[model samples]
Target chain A: MVLKVGILGGANIANKISRAINSIPDVAQVVVVGSREASKAAAFIERNKLVHASPVAGYDAVLDFPGVEAVYIPLPTALHVEWVQKAASKGLHIVLEKPIAIEDEHVDAIVKAAADANVVLFDGTMWMHHPRTAAMEAALQEIGPVWDVDSAFTFKGSADFLENNVRVKADGDPLGALGDVGWYCVRAILWAYDFTPPTHVAAHHGALFNEAGVPLNIAATLLFPGGRKARFLAAFDTVFTSKLEVYGDRGSLRLRDFVIPTAEHEASFVVATANGLADGDTRIATVEETRTVRNAVTQEAALWQRFAREIEVVRAGGRAPEYWPRIAALTERVLSAVLASARQGCALLPFEHRA
Target chain B: MVLKVGILGGANIANKISRAINSIPDVAQVVVVGSREASKAAAFIERNKLVHASPVAGYDAVLDFPGVEAVYIPLPTALHVEWVQKAASKGLHIVLEKPIAIEDEHVDAIVKAAADANVVLFDGTMWMHHPRTAAMEAALQEIGPVWDVDSAFTFKGSADFLENNVRVKADGDPLGALGDVGWYCVRAILWAYDFTPPTHVAAHHGALFNEAGVPLNIAATLLFPGGRKARFLAAFDTVFTSKLEVYGDRGSLRLRDFVIPTAEHEASFVVATANGLADGDTRIATVEETRTVRNAVTQEAALWQRFAREIEVVRAGGRAPEYWPRIAALTERVLSAVLASARQGCALLPFEHRA
Candidate 1:
């Protein structure tokens, strides 16, 4: 019942999934690694210790590999639309990396391709598969209804990376920081709101763009129905910071490493509930409790195991869980609105259009 | 020499300063309690056990009280213009409770009157006086130049408080949540940004208002020079949550009880610096250290001691600290821009006027 997976790129992130799949050979195994150059793919396989995987010359070669049941597409965001559709047409289940596409239409096209092909299409947001995410969400019920959310993910890119990295190339990442780290910030907020889209989105007035017009840093505020609000920021010019906080009427929940847990096996979130009122109205005490979740597998491995399950369902002629692609589409559409708002001096963009 | 202070209102906050001054008997003393009704003043004196203080029939009488060298004005926002000008004219050094005035012109006027009278004007933001505040700010240097800030102060108001309280009364505390709790959120961001006004400001699309057209909840984003950004939220319709986080290029510092210290004698902040890189491209570890500051007296008492010291300086024929009034004016100007942006459907408001 092992799913044979072909990896379509030799990107650095591919090393993560390769290790994950190899670690959980019973659930999934990497059978082929593909890069524009065969030598790079061979190097990747060796570096990640993928013994069961072989190198292939091109992306299509990986897709055409015999017995390739599913393909993990870690290609640049700009290439997702074409490759994802091609893989879907090839009848291979797909694990699309984050920011499935730069344009909204492309996201719709990828989702439609998967739906038409009846294959699993999961966006590779590793943190979503973490057990601690669910545990934190469960604690939300006790905090009353969520009224506010704030999240940020920022890492200072070395100057060389900024100059030579595909992420800063307009023809590649295009969405830049927004598509890279901002993807997680957006996804986390959506998850907090139970996948509900905000009513309106507006970027901060100071979104920075690289020389190639790729966003370097961007921040936005979203207003949902009932006055609920969320703000997210992502940048490539700050020290590493990943945090997500969802505040309800009675309390709040926070995690320092939300996009990626600081530790591989153990993750925790703090629940802050109000307590003792200081004698003066100066300040009141907050009762904080840290809840921890320990998982035997890395979140990436967990993601692969779950995607493999989806592949298993599809292989058995059953429908895969369609929620993942839909989540990706919703996330992309909101990101589109944010980027659009940023492009236009932070104009307000409504999710739904009405006269 | 003790500074004799007159209390201008019998509001709940009066109990705090009364106790603070009573505790530090040498620096300051509450000489008179004033209210519209002499009986309420008497009741306030009795409730606070102000043995050395006498009740006065009216605010003017307190201003005229013999030996009264200073005044604590915790009047609602709407009344500040008249009383602050009156107190300054009477040559009484003033501790003006926050949101000094609803209008920018009034804030300027209050500052002008204080300057003309050569009397000290201090905004009653107690947390500013905490030693931990200085400790936290000093820690910011190691974090590198702050590029982002996020702060919030929210408390769920009881139904009765919303319905019957001055905070929700348009003619009384017109700014409502913004003036009351939002003052802290705005001040914290300003503090993080080194008292520099943002280049532009924009509010979130949604701002809730009570029946009297008083804002009950608001959130806004501020964009500073060099692409640095800040966002703040304040609400009277949510559970108590006061947080301030200043993020720089290298690290960040956060306080759970920024608006008011959780403990009267101690406050702490967490400084998180990046550490161990996770094996995968997953999240790296963060090194967090909590530094605590323990004070011999409450922050409110510290506020009184400092203000009383200013009184001492003036009594010795020296000039008072001009930085404080300037800080209050700058905070008010930034707040004015934020509120203006909120009123105009989150329009971008610049701090300075230009072509």
Candidate 2:
């Protein structure tokens, strides 16, 4: 059965998700495209050659659409939690394009709504499902235990975006650039380290400015438990660059262009052995399995399908409802601390996230 | 008359200083080289074709030389304070290389000795004296009011150094690899922001590994006051890379290679302006300034000579002897807090240097 998907905004991310849905096999079908501006929604539908497009005059209209099983939210950062909570209250599954909310309180409401309704709610973190990320994680396992990780994702963007975009203006905090990009980086480190979130967290926050004298770049460091740590550099006013390194006890894994890349497939591994602790020494390793990966968007759609299966099983009383709330709460907790550290200009120690 | 410079050890930095002294005009003369191992000092003297070379036991004889006016102490990190104090008490001018001393207590005694003896004490912070650094700072005036600055310097060595070197040997408390290269980065940021050290400091520390899975790699962050901050990364078991970036309101100046570059010269800067903010178009006005710096070591030596002159003038009633004592005390206080923050895994609040 095809799971019908509706887009609630005419933004770039929604358009990309819509395109990806069409490519997925028996998964998501783009049913309706809605926007506050009817002409914008019509143009987006016409551009994508979709059949249904409507003005988002009210939330009830999108929720009651025939065959609309899930809503893919691509609103501004400020509206994520409000829309997610509303959709889940109406028994609609949600694929939220993060950071989940402008504040942690909204994430709490969304978590409660999803828990009470027993509905599927997944944050849109497509990179988590990317093939390279999985490969990087598998490579970490080969190295035994991960000891440290370093990451950076920076790009040169306009000063206007830094000072006046949905980030600082709508969210009331300019450090969302770190949240938007650094979240993927932090999660990648956690995933590599077996989903262990930082027990103690510390960070230094600062911004880069453009010719117009506006803050357009930001960077931070996150300390995790058991001595595992991560460093992130997110910029909208510098050169374009992205890279990640995971250093383990036995070896290390390096990923260049961690977030986005357009070059030849380039990756490396360093192993520490009896001889001089491996210093970028190359070695031939055997590949035991051969597999192909779908495009990023298609893979994300597939993960959404997995979310649907989990939701269905739970609704049928085959799975416990407690699990989803924990993950949701954890996500909100981590994201909240990241922003708080940036605001406070110091590390915010992690607190217990009670569901 | 040429200023006779006697190097007390045949260390790596000593060799660099000898070469730099050769390039500068009417400043430094490599008159004598001495070491406990006579052969080591002889080899350095012969390799550099210096005028005199002797064993460490003949320190008094070398100091008695008519031309020996200044002593350049490039001993181990632990010996910085002792040698500087000894040289100052002997009525000889001193050029002390960083970090000055690993411990805060050592700084007070050393600074006092130099003051009482009426001798100049110059910390060999050459990168700040490099022409590109001057250009970067001068460009800051063009960029407008500075908001935030980020700096980094990272390199790789063997795991043995992590355990054996004074840098990571934990003076009283366990000091990670951060105390070595990390100090330079922290000092650079503090100096860039006019020595207003952060009231709060926090850090995330990590390790590479030893045979027994001990820490051999570390990275950390420091929060400074007025929204100024820094992050530093260093390892004894990875690759080598260094970068320093100063982001301002109107633009940013960056030095990709802060130190130890293979090329003859390294460093560059970029200035970007928002077009819309400038009253017209909806595009950014961006400009980049790129240039290669020359003779970083010699530039530092020149700065040292100027500092000597200033110290002489300041001693002639321009400034009180108490002025520099406060500066030295404040620097040590900052270093102590950084060490505490790294060890405790929490923000170390700043305090007045009582001693």
> For each candidate, what is the lDDT?
0.87, 0.59
**Each predicted complex: what DockQ?**
0.60, 0.09
Residue-wise C-alpha lDDT for candidate 1, range B2-26, written one tens digit per residue: 8899999898888888988888998
Report the alpha-carbon TM-score of model 2 versus the true structure. Answer: 0.70
Interface RMSD of 1: 2.3
Off by over 4 Å in 1: A275-277, A353-355, B275-277, B353-355
TM-scores of the models, in the order given: 0.97, 0.70
Per residue, candidate 1 scores C-alpha lDDT tens digits across A1-355 of: 8899999988888988888888898998899999999999999999989888889999999999999999999898989999999999999999999889998889889999999999899998999999998898899888878888888888888999888898889988988899889999999998989888789998887788988899888988888888888889888876677889998878888887887887778999999887535656766866889999998898999998888877777777898777998898988888889999998878888886211
Candidate 1 chain A vs. true chain A: TM-score? 0.97
Residue B74 local lDDT, model 1: 94
Candidate 2: give the clashing pairs: A157-A236, A211-B272, A211-B273, A213-B249, B170-B175, B198-B224, B198-B225, B208-B217
Give the local distance difference test score of model 1.
0.87
Q: Give me candidate 1's TM-score against the actual structure.
A: 0.97
